[model samples]
Target: MLCYRKHSLFTKKYHIFKYDNEIHLGETTTKIKYTINLTPQTMIDWSINHQTKQLNGFWLIWKKQQKFFLMDATTCNLFKQTLNGIVTYGKHQILYEPIQSLLHSSFGSLVKMKYLNSRDSYMCKTIQKSLQYTDDDFYYQIEILQSLNHTNILKLKEVYNSNKNYHFVFDFPEGGSLADLIKTKQLQFKEVQLIIRQLISTISFIHSKGYVHRNLKPEHIFFKESNNLESLLISEFELGCRLVDFQNKHPNCRVHGYTAPEIKSKIFTQKCDVFSCGVILYKILTRKDLFDHESITYDEKMMLHLINQSDIDPQYQNLLRKMLQFNPELRATADQCLTIIDAILERTPTFSNFLDRFNLDIIYLIYL
Candidate 1:
């Protein structure tokens, strides 16, 4: 049995009983029993919170006695206080109803309020169902995030779990996604080069941790600032993109035309990311969709198709062919890609050489 002493914050005295991995909390001893999973700290956190309301998803103050605790109505009963404080569960009331309404109408997805930070920004996400509801997905996410620390990868702040749901809180990036930017025709060649480098570095990190980002597409690549070409941010990990997701379980990877042949056969590895990277590079270089017929004009498609099918530019064609290899084993590794990129960079002539040949202002801009 776990016992908690009433603090100055709460006026009532509450005693908690624990037996057989279950805990009971009430104002006084009662014959009725409610099944609950409790750690010593969970009951302690609940005892300190003066406010307890049904609509406000079981309330509990996490920090108490210099320790953190997880508490909800199921785990423990709440004690009443003389003063009333706002507490209710269910869907949280958004202070900016207009914004919430707009998002709801636009997305038309069920958004659950997860957490409210010190900045008053609410963290919310659409609920998703998973085949494995246990800690498999949760642990996989934690392991992947902890393994790779890069500017291009999305930042996960924390995770919250209740009896009915799980929530992931992440650092919000204002720039939207690469997919959106590509739609606006804002991505340039130099910007694409930078983005690809960052992405390769991130993929290298993931591979180092023995994981493959099965789903690597423009939509998954988030941005920090909408028009900022240098912005770096990424998000979305709900899919089976982790090592555990692929561990001994064969599932066909999905990413439209970006998916490699090995992925379709359910034999994916780090090299699959290289194939996706090639597709992304093709899009970046031409600023046209490789698959979307409506987005790419006939002339653009003809040009890209020709370049892809023929050796018009041997060097570029070689690189593209190596990346788009049908077999995973034949594709380039992250380290190999890095080396190739370095070679390409070294081969690129300086602006001074161009100026010497054509008497151009390119050298001045480069020097400046």
Candidate 2:
């Protein structure tokens, strides 16, 4: 294929060539004419003066539009030697490395993809379900997730389509899920506050946007650490939806001890997410092993009892009690939780904090 190079307005050079019938022209700051695609059926005509090597002329008529572009004399001569009816350049094909290792298969639809850049990577999510549901659900989820920007929510990179599943790529945080990170140890008071603050902020933002997370659990919260600062991120939007547009009053709720009781009565509200947050907080505060799956098999009712039975520090006891309240109306909202967090943060940490006051070195010595 004939190739041309052009320095952008900023003088950054990029290879301009036709690939798969599309001219892959790109630079970091381009806002227009990024790429151009033409099918085999496309009618186009162009010629270059053999000596002058300038674009004598070119124009394409496709459907109702006629388009034309000019190439300077310098560009014309640059590709003249290999310009053999636009087919001489060797074809470049993309190869996929076989997925030999999988980090997660909870959804039974994960394919480890190639690493992309220094700070980002790609993983394929294959989604397959009954055809009864319209494909629009995928677009709706994308719309909501794309518009949402928060530290706690994972960022979606892009999406791809296949015969069976809609594959998604997300910005993978290096530090895995909270469930994976906190298995052996409990967090200090300041760490817990930082994590809870992010969760509360995430829920409140989504609620304000008319969407409900519907599923909230520790596993959904991922950990990210950089420059000695830590961050918590929420992932898995498979069940996320707009509260106003959602028609299913009784959608199946995931995560056993984390689900609220009102879900059984076909009642849905933002408070449901708050309840799940409470379950996470209780687990973090007490560092107790949550009731197991076997309990779920015997009776789901135990989950309701599990939430209320957590004996936490008295300071947070009142806030947790309000958050995990069995009655939907009595359940604390995310905004309310934020207010409580502010109050907790404002107060001096003595007995109120989950962790005892200590210098970092002393605390590490104690734990070590």
Candidate 3:
């Protein structure tokens, strides 16, 4: 038997009975027994478990040769619902109810609440405590995300404030992140091109609003399945990827190799993001760590040495040098990178050319 509790919205909390095949509704033990075929169209049936006297949360059950087996419900539902959507290949699936939340620290202590609905799969990060500095950093991140709209940039759906926290909800990307993908292999040129284009577009959108994503790294860029073909980048905002920790208020702030030299000297601007973008670009292209792994501290000297010694394509090397210039004024801007990429596309035959060679339009549609 299955019991159901009517909750907010169209969501129903249901429980299952093992002995008697019936759906229990509220206090009445309704004898109505209906077997619903598990499919994408089926809503989660949640109810209270009479035996345990606790909520028998929604779950998926399977029958094999007259034996019944039950597993976590949300996992079954998420798999079915996002069957056509993006998926992480080797990462562990994080399972939790809609009410579950996690506490994280970004500059100060914060709370992240996950929105579990199919359409509204998002996470809301809220500043739970403010110490030493003001709330300007929090407000800045919120304002920057709220002002922009792009496929690459994580969309800020809404904002709320309470005495304890300031919350901002943004879109969730299920494909994990660029950092995770990089662990697999060096991205093909076409994939890199697509990623760079999306990144450029996101940076351009941010610059147009007089802000910079100072913390532009692989982890900050999320990946999601765009369609049946390729993955999309989902940039985290609202202190998730923003330079919240490195704000002017904090005298001692750092982001290891991704931080430009000028930024180290307190001379920072939007170009700082471009510098970080260059490091990220080099990392994706070479599938190498920006810095050495054995060092406990961020070895700036070693990073500089590697930057100079790395044998890369002359064109790419030139761009990297320009981006990492010690002088802030000498560094390339996001707009400049876009133009350079356009020129590169025009002058250089790309993997797209190879696609043309094979007449692989389907592959092109999948990636490009």
User: Which ranges of candidate 1 are over 4 A from the true structure?
Assistant: 1-127, 130-135, 162-164, 240-245, 252-255, 292-306, 309-316, 349-352, 359-368
What TM-score does candidate 3 reach? 0.58
Candidate number of the best TM-score: 2
Best by lDDT: 2
| TM-score for each predicted model, relative to the true structure | 0.63, 0.64, 0.58
Alpha-carbon deviation at 349 in model 1, angstroms? 4.8
TM-score of 1: 0.63
Tens-place lDDT digits, model 1, residues 11-54: 33345554554445555567422333432223211222334332
For model 2, where is the 10-residue window of minimal lDDT? 87-96
Residue-level lDDT of model 2, residues 100-217, one tens digit each, is: 3444554436554553112234444556644432346556566667678777788765553334555555655557677765685677777778788888888999999888888787
Q: Please give the lDDT score at residue 48 for candidate 2.
A: 52
lDDT of each residue in 249-303, candidate 3, tens digit only:
4343455666665655665577878877888888987888775434423455676
